[model samples]
Target: MTSPDVLDSYAPVVAEWYSANARDLPWRRAGTTPWGVLVSEVMLQQTPVVRVAPAWHEWLARWPTPAALAADQPGEAIRAWGRLGYPRRALRLHECAVAITERHGGVVPSVLDELLALPGVGTYTARAVAAFAYGQRHPVVDTNVRRVAARAVLGEPDAGPTTTAADLTLVESLLPLEPPLAALVSAALMELGAVVCVARTPRCGVCPLAERCRWLISGAPAPVGPTRRPQTYAGTDRQVRGKLLAVLRESHGPVAKDALDAVWGDQVQRERALAGLLEDGLVVTPAPGIYALP
Candidate 1:
């Protein structure tokens, strides 16, 4: 039942709002390299913007191009990753740099399929790079964009569990005709969802779409049943893995199993966590019972 006119108005209105209100992220700045956009996307996956800002600056300074990163060891990527959480992303990014070097002559590929072929690049990332980095008109749907589309267009409190094909179709339907403007609209939608139409306690009074939002017109009903569960980190294998990785990252050379063993008290949980890291290719067994980053 979503009106076509209302959806059509989204790009222009949100684009204007974003021009005045978008955050001053480095990656959004003019002349930022495609590699910068790629790195920022990977870092921003599960981490917050406030934390990502400095790390992003440092990362680009150290390895400004894929060629620079591809020249270094993968372990150096992990070391420079610096408490970003999900250190595996660092390894994947390293592999992505290598792929770019070998496959695309060290430049971030502009074509969506070529970008998607890089290690750890997913649909969202591929489309984001194509649209944001290359000025190609592709829908860049993330959690934030999905939520914005759901509430503003569908009158829903939240989006589905994850971005689906329908999500891409919905956003693409709203995009402007011109490629550059379409990219702008995509960024604007993400910014709106991130800041104004946030998951909890959205500040609708400040929202650009407050007057036309479907969810707002529908009384903004609370989500039905129990809300989605939040992820826990304490006492989990993830925490154990993080602790072990921190030890390895701080060390210049391979860390003995005893050193890793001392990081977590529970032998079973620690072993499980270490095994997971090894299986993930984040950690390598340089020798029997000796661990180092790959």
Candidate 2:
């Protein structure tokens, strides 16, 4: 790992690079409301920024704040989550809105623990919302930040397949004081990892972290390798679940199982997927064999 003195040199450069090259994503702008930040972070959980932007705008415009969403039906929220792949996030968001209204007086909680208590708010999301929305000094380690931290600070070729609590602490140590600056630096590291210090083809020649990177100094090694390719959607249970859920989402009342059966013909696999969704609480069997969104 690079010593703190060496690591310090790269910070200014990263901050500069971020300021100049960061994408003009709506949620990153100054004066963005906390609710806007919360919505963007949630939409971005398993979805890409490019796809989340328009949906974020629509959600915020319609709901504007937690109370607005709290008052609306969950069906509207699910439908508003158009083409985001994982529609469950919309439902969780609706739950979060209700929680915020009842528990936090309709305001996004600034404290990390309070944020974590919200529905669908995991460790990464909690820290992200705290740091990004409230400008708090917390480790906001997403996949991008993890990759950057491993390479730049530890000289590692790649981060582990999943996050650990230690990873959070290490990243937190790198953060400077002044909450806004800390937030910016966390974003800077992520941006560096995303665009320049990429997974497959790192642009080390132009990378600001090059001078201090342990990986570069050690002669970057090949990564340990991904454990698996992305889970395939084709003919998978997720596809079947999406199909079944789509029908119920479109219809107001309970949908006959026959209509859902028509979506995916594989009787055995289709039944398994539907059962899984029901078990996951994403679907409800209103009556005997009739399904609807929960």
Candidate 3:
């Protein structure tokens, strides 16, 4: 077997491993509609799978299609979002629903460019939808994919924070030619990264790539990048934003300014957080002294 053959050998083993080990994600079900996949992908963007699971089910139950979500008020969407932290994504997802209903005739677009043009769809997300929804062969490189490829293939302990154009090419070249196989392979690689090739403590023993890992051969050098920490929510803008949104989410319409002030004790910080949400279009001041979820 040649070098390409050697590289390609990993696919079958990975797919086999995936068959037995893959988590029973609803979106991965045989008859899962594209709308369900899109919803799962959007909700999974920055939130963890554990948090997204129930929300995903509840959301699909309420609005199984884009046209249905598009018909709902943004206020309801925010309330449904329920402390997801990044509330802006909720607004953008609502806009995406409206755009999909209007432009794509309520169908999730399969073309990468078409998906990219939709609001809130970024490079990773666009490719993910195209490949997963339509059986297209495109590299779906999220943080997990990047990290796994970096360590197992490129000999890098960690992928840098930013995804470069070259990173996409590197991952794309490894994808199988067959569309469905390629899609399965992409998900398998992501699963490997998330579960086995973890950031803090990689489980090399169970990893399919353990024997072939470049990082293992290179003696596992430290990451040549800035380290990060779990973000502190207390006294941060995120906490304040959560506080402000909670008030608006509970209210039917515009909440009195004084009512919002009751959520956070610090008057100045609460005001700033409300202003930030308004600037981000997550909230609107329907009246002079009242706030509401936008």
Q: For each candidate, what is the lDDT?
A: 0.92, 0.86, 0.85
Off by over 4 Å in 1: none
How far off is residue 294 in model 2, in Å?
Answer: 3.1
lDDT per residue for candidate 3 within 1-294, as digits (tens), equals 126765676677777888899998888888888888887888889899989988888888998999999999987888998876687888888999999999999998988999999888999889888888888999899999999888877888999787789789877777889999999899888898888889899998898887888898789898765687788889987898888888787777787888888888887888888888989999988789977886
- The runs of at least 3 residues in candidate 3 whose Cα sits more than 4 Å from the true structure, single-residue gaps closed, are 1-3, 224-231
TM-score of each: 0.97, 0.93, 0.94
Better of 1 and 2 by lDDT: 1
Ranking by lDDT: 1, 2, 3
Candidate 2: tens digits of C-alpha lDDT, residues 112-201: 999998889998899888988888888898898889889878889888878999899888778776788888898898888878998888
TM-score attained by model 3:
0.94
lDDT (C-alpha) at residue 105 in model 3: 97
Point to the candidate with the largest lDDT: 1
Clashing pairs in model 3?
none
Residue 169 error for model 2, in Å?
Answer: 1.9
